[model samples]
Target: MSDTGGLFDGVLAAGPVAESVCDGAWVQAMLDFEAALAWASAAAGVIPEAAAVDIEKRCRAEYYDIAALGAAAVRIGNPAGPLVRELTASVAPEAAAYVHLGATSQDVLDTAAMLVTARALIALRAGLHACADRLAQLAEEHAGTVQAGRSLLQQAPPVTFGLTVAGWLGGVVAALDRIDVLRGERLAVQFGGAVGTLAALGDNGIPVLRGIAFRLGLAEPVLPWHTERSRIAEIAGALGQASGAVAKIARDITLLAQTELGEVFEQGPPGSGGSSTMPHKRNPVAAVLAAGSAAQAPGLVATLLSAAAHEHQRAAGSWHAEWRPLTELLRSTGSAVEWLCIALDRLRVDPARMRANLEASGGLLLAEQVAIGLVAAAQGAVGRQEATDLVAACCLRAGPDDLAELLAADEVIGKYLDRSRIDELLDPTGYLGSTAAFIQRAVQDWRSRSAGYR
Candidate 1:
């Protein structure tokens, strides 16, 4: 990313997750597994405590040459073999014998992935909760603030801005809940020896697995899942869904902030989002970055899905296929969360503009309201379609003072309603039915769910 010369460094990739899944972080995670394994073996009485301490002292990632290890991995096919080989050489012969005694390369690698994933999820949770908080606040503040609802890109009827933000908050809350579940249930230690059977440890294998889980703060699995890949697939799907949720907010904000409908504004510094040539352009740069991350998500998730087709006990190529793609997919989701948080936290709302735009349609949106009001007043005199067409036809002609005035001057429907009732029918603010109640429900639901999560 540094070599790319600040492509999305600050915009998308500047979140808490960027550091947790870096190359350096991967190296450290793998090294931590080797040390944790030694600790687990000692606790299980499979290896002497003194030898475990000796091996642990030298299991630091810094002791290994990073570049040389990467280059050596090209011939061996993975960095794990070279890393283990170097770790073995770094320890005394007595200690080296027990360094990776009961484990295989996949155990170290899979557990390392879980470690990185756990830390990154913590960051993701924080970012997601922050976004939810912002939306919750907006929902509460704008509960009664009226705006025009649109369908197929055209104005339809009246709605509260709060309800729209509530929808976005609900999606983020759902995603957060599912990701937390996956973290709790699927984040188990991977410790199957050689071919999914702990042949090296014999009867001590299960005990060693429990020991590793306790030491690493992970969960113990029912069995070693070297070949079963549902855990990884489920997590990838959750992240993919989360990315979609993030993109929804971005898409809505970008759409609302268009020149013709200046309902919101993107957040950035003065010089940020400025066009290269246009002097007055302030583009929705945050949304652009989030959209880019989402655009990459489906393909990255596909790679993980395709890689699930692993062979027999261990996959040859398919197992290798997961490394780069899974990391990239997680990175893309991380970036989306990070950028969406920034965009949401500092969002600029224009309630006045929203009101103005709703009324800009000149009561065309209030046709349904007027028609329904006429029916209630008419009893049996005004037919539904007749009232509907009466208001619809009024939309095409010049009005007296406003829509209500024009409706009152109508030939047939005017006999049913007086001026005060017409005013009620034409009020967009009054027509936002149950918007505040829905916002409160969404906000309360989020509070309840997130309280349990925390």
Candidate 2:
């Protein structure tokens, strides 16, 4: 890679992603595959246990020059070949002979990829849980806090902010559940030798495959999946779904933090989110990071899907296409979840501003309630459209201190509804129908679901 990744990675990649999927980690995983292969072969009696111990002793990636190995790998077309050559050279000839006995280049590379991914998932799971828990907490805190429900950028009716957060939390919860399933099933060992057959091992392949998988904490497939690429594509898709879920929340928070409609803001120290030209600005830096990282998922995932369509058995250029994109998918998704955890945890909410925005639409926001009140009060004197028109006309002027006084001034509407009923109808808090119930459902469901994982 370059000194830095693409524009987004520098802005959005978190420390965990950098640590988990870096060249060092990759090399370590490859070395781990070598060590496990040696141990498995020895356990199967293909090699002496003493040779296995010797090979394992030398398998630490720290002992090798990764830069030289990486350069040699490019020329050799894969890292395992160059790595095994150096390994055999380092150990006694008898022990070195057992270094990568039954495995091929793809086996080492693919298994290494799994090891890297398994480590990455540990970070991702924690991030997602943290974010979800924060959202659930916020949902409980703001259960009855009223805000304007918007549709197509226009005010529709009253909705609690808690309900809105519940929707976002719901998406994240689904992503977490999907991740729980995929990690268990997809993070398995890849041990197919050259040409997808362990013909060289002669009936010992299955035992060796199972042994190495057990050593690596991975599942062994019943048969070689050299060409079946669903697991790879599924991992990409699942990761994309997770990033996309968090992106929805980031986009919403960014919108909420807009200057004209500042219902909420991210909690940060002084000078955070400051614009160079506009000193008064406090931008949504955390949301920017969350969105920026998530933005890479779809295209990278598409590349993974394309890479899955490789040519016969081992693939020509197609399999090679997967290395970077898959790593990027893992990095971006994990980083997105990490940043969202920060943004959600430190989010500063202004329930007062949310209520003000709800009422900013004037009594027009209560037009639906007014129309419903008119049906009963007017009896046959007014219809729904007439009631709607009357409220619209009255709303052209600013509302009075009380909506009851405002409507009492109306010669036409005063007879239909009185002051007490008007006050009751115009209250946004009373109009939040089932919003709190939904929020409660979300919080309780989250508590229950998160319990199982814990």
Candidate 3:
């Protein structure tokens, strides 16, 4: 019946977003816990060597204040207040003196959240890089792998599987780049007291604040951020963007794997699906989940944007609403990354299917190639319009059988090229331009940049 109990209950039942935030609690806890240790160690010197050791042990100890912490959070409409009260209470009175010393509620909360965000970002960056690498590998492995490239749910032209993979890789690489940039940007901390000043800590405020940041592995900001919510918004936005990228890839995969277009399929044993009536159906469950999670990211980002509109010094509504939703976005995004990685890793590529599909449209897909050939043969004798007209006429008049016969018999074309040569040019495999080369470039670039972290 208590407010905290209700809060805990709500958080417990939350979807992926809540789970991410919940799992992230440990990282946040570690930051705050260390802050207390540093503060205690710096102040009163009341924290002895043995007690320091004890504090470390106790801080490392696994404990949950879900109910109490949740209740406190509701009372103050924020987690920081409840978290400080509970943690301070848990420490021995001697060690407790150092707990939260010279630091306001926002100090521990924001920095701790940043620590968690940093870790999450690191993990996410790695996941995106991995996805990019997988895509590159797939592109490399199937560089000349031909398939029908579809547009508007209909076959359009001959395209290599490598080219398709490369496109996906491009998106992943871009997302990775964004993540890298975000990591380097200074994530400001919330250090100010009740207002926007370090008045609580008096003259010792700056030093003590720096000490807390140093001990907790966080960046020190010039001032407290009771009102400036940009960093938080930026972090949320980054996460949302990354999730959206992953979702787009998932959506593409799901579409490509549709039974009607079966050019590719999920690699593993099909996970369970709906009704007993549709016994043969094996849905694209992982892809769907990834896509759905991705679809939710934009809304989360919007919420973060809304949160950024805090009133001059503080705005409770905008700030408080950010905690849970942002947490959920982080969690869902992480899950989506994990799922996408698995899906990409085990993807089933069908070069033959690609080839067959490409060929299904007859040699019409090679209309462009024919036009080029005509232009070359004409040697400026015919304009582009004339060449295109000739090629179009040839394509429409010739079926697969006829096209093969004509290519063999026509002196102007056949004398210069053979059946195999024409097939090679018309084939998606040979026409993939620089797909393989691009994949290699991406792989090298990503590996070089991600070397330290990987």
Best by TM-score: 1
- Candidate 1 stretches greater than 4 Å from native: 1-8, 380-390, 396-406, 409-412, 449-454
Q: What tens digits encode model 3's per-residue C-alpha lDDT throughout 1-454? A: 4353333233222232333356436435544545554554555343455555545544542464565656666677766666666566777777666555555666566676776676677677777778877887787888778777667877666667777777777777777766666677666455666776767556766666666666666667877776787787778777877887888788888887878777777756645333467877766666766676667678878888887878877676877777767776787787777778867866787777767767876667776676576567657765678666755666667876576556546555665557776676565555556666776776677567666546
- Looking at model 1, residue 323 earns an lDDT score of 80
Best-fitting candidate, scored by lDDT = 1
What is the C-alpha local distance difference test score of candidate 3?
Answer: 0.66
Q: For model 2, state the Cα shift of residue 426 in Å.
A: 2.1
Model 3, C-alpha of 385: deviation from truth (Å): 3.2
lDDT per residue for candidate 1 within 1-454, as digits (tens), equals: 2374256566556677878887777888888888888888898899999888988888777787888989998886888888989998888888888888889889888888888888888888888898898899999898887889999999988998899999999989989988988898898888998998899998989988898888888889999888888878987888888999998888999899898998988878788678989989888877777777767789988888888987899889877888887777777788898888878865788999999998887778888998999998999788899889898888878453467667888988789899888878888877877888899999999987777665
TM-score of 3: 0.82
For each candidate, the alpha-carbon lDDT, in order, equals 0.85, 0.84, 0.66
User: Candidate 3, after superposition: displacement of residue 127 in Å?
Assistant: 3.0
Candidate 2 global TM-score: 0.90
- Cα lDDT, model 1, residue 421: 87
* RMSD value for candidate 2: 3.0
Ranking by lDDT: 1, 2, 3
Clashing pairs in 1: none
Candidate 2, pairs of clashing residues: none
